[model samples]
Target: MMALFRNLFAAALFVGILAAFEPLNYKDCKSTFKINSVKADGCPQENGKCVFKQSTFKINSVRADGCPQENGKCVFKRGTNPTIKISFIPDRDLPKLKASVRSKISGGSTFTTFSLNNDNACEHGIECPLKAGQTYEYTQSVEIVNTYPVVDDVQVNWVLSDEDDSNKKEICIVFLAKITE
Candidate 1:
């Protein structure tokens, strides 16, 4: 009997240790953004100006490190991998998602664009057939593939829509970003 109790205790301790190292749930996490090894508040700005934006979805937490945030926004570099994390609630079923990004130089006429489609939310690691009124954190990595002489601003947009009707967007999120180099 004593050996049985000891074995159970060991197993319980092992489980506890594993759970302690698990990544925090989206709601409970309070992570910060890092740019070039520096902590940032949001995306970067240009000429002391940053056009910050968000969406109707409830964002519990956000972090965009590769794209450092400054002056209440974030900044990205050309030919770099910029990552973004957002925890939000759809508030309705969303079978698919449409995401697009475009950038216009701060003082130039150059532009850069990238578009993606998530036919099945789960295929992209997002819960598909998303339950209405449930919150989920989405982390996406965007590669800046433009070689424009200048990339001043970026507009990140996402549309959550039903599978049957692409024209009907249940939710929309548009965020602006500043770029350098």
Candidate 2:
């Protein structure tokens, strides 16, 4: 009975810290392939074959396009000024990248992935501690200054996960996506 009570107490404390959103952080996904929104014209349907979504929703600082199962990247034309912003980032960090990575876009299982490469401050690490039933957020913006005419579509996807078990209590993925064109 005493041990049971002790476990309950610990669980409560963890819940409290997570509720506070303590272990919070973000990763700015950069691609060798840059994006240029103005030149790219519009996010393609059938890969630039469709009209841009026209809604009055709030636009996020980062603009992201959907990732296709077949395409390895979200493409953009070389001269089209790259827009390398992370349109949607989860409130929590997912598992660390493995050379033999296994990932599914938006819970779907057509595993299409790539190696995560980056710089300091946005290095390989974990961020967590966002309460269940609560929402936390992070945003990143990058201008795709480099554009190649050869490129066609620009695809992106976001995943919130708790791959780091060391900090069991601190785990989250704040979802942030582009709301405007």
Candidate 3:
């Protein structure tokens, strides 16, 4: 009887650990723009930002069909489209901008390119000639095709560059994701 109780306790502890969702980890690749916050469908929002614990920034599990965390990584289902919203303030005026999305699997040096419906930032949500120091919200839908292999620990990178000078990146963000069936 005592052994049974011990086993039950151990199982419960393991399940609890798995249920604790870690905060989304993101980085500004170019450091040219200030990312105010990022959130998906089910994350809690407050004061125009996603509400997360201060110390660890742990997020809660999302609803079904929404981007949820499993094994401490955000899960994106194949053949489904997930929308991501980002708030940022650019340092310089961006008269024209182009968007690019790419993914790099774990331990892989080469990145696979992905396409958005329209590569123009102005077409998506941003107004033409974005003013500096003004916060702007940009929303995009990522199409996860059925052909993509089920991969773990994939680095998804999104960049907005100047159409005139491709080298000048206005904003660059990289986040971790997992693709599942």
Candidate 4:
């Protein structure tokens, strides 16, 4: 009985570690950005495809500081700012870039757009005229205003598009988050 208990405990520990490092599920919107593969930390890939979800634009990783996971979703408190860190590699040279965020409440057909204080990527950490085949990291703190409805299972989409042509996207990522009081 002692050996059986020890084995079970070890297996459970291993499983928990795997779950904690699971990659963010995302979908790459079809656009001008071209890359061979996008890789995230601890995220596994098979046959040139991400195992978690079907995505062409893979980011290194996305971290939301001050947001805690509750019941498998990141909980964001109202009227607070959460810092987001993203690591990615641009496949093409981009002179100017703009960033935007939108959210879709669970069971809602339309997505509500959120305003950012500074939408310019250059104002953030990124230098203008981004080079191809080079990696870049962007950090920004987004405000979760009080006006937002407190809800669960909200689908948030973050996009980086070319300033000259909004249709040309440099990066597009989606993740699940929840808003709470």
- Best-fitting candidate, scored by lDDT: 4
Candidate order (TM-score): 3, 4, 1, 2
Candidate 1 per-residue lDDT over residues 20-106, each given as its tens digit: 221111221111211111112233333333222334444454444465544433566777766554555665666655444455545
lDDT tens per residue, model 3, 1-181: 9999999999999876434322344443445656565556532222222222211111122111245655545578898877665566777677877888898999999999987988887776678787877777666777999999999888776667789986766666666678999
Q: Write the per-residue lDDT of candidate 2 for residues 1-181, one digit (tens) a residue.
A: 9999999999999786333221112222332111112111123223222112211111122232231112223343322322222222233334332111122334344744423333211232213332222222322222333321222333333222233432321211122122112
Global lDDT of each candidate: 0.47, 0.27, 0.63, 0.64
Which candidate order results from sorting by lDDT in descending order? 4, 3, 1, 2
TM-score quality measure for candidate 2: 0.26
TM-score, every prediction:
0.56, 0.26, 0.70, 0.70
- What is the C-alpha lDDT profile of model 4 across 11-123, one tens digit per residue? 99988743533333344455344322322333332223221122223455554554565555566789887666556667677788888888899899999888899999778
**What shift in Å separates residue 164 of candidate 1 from its native position after superposition?**
3.6
Error of 3 at 57 (Å): 22
Looking at candidate 4, the ten consecutive residues that score lowest on lDDT are: 46-55
Off by over 4 Å in 3: 1-25, 43-65
- For candidate 2, what is the lDDT? 0.27
lDDT of model 1, residue 30? 19
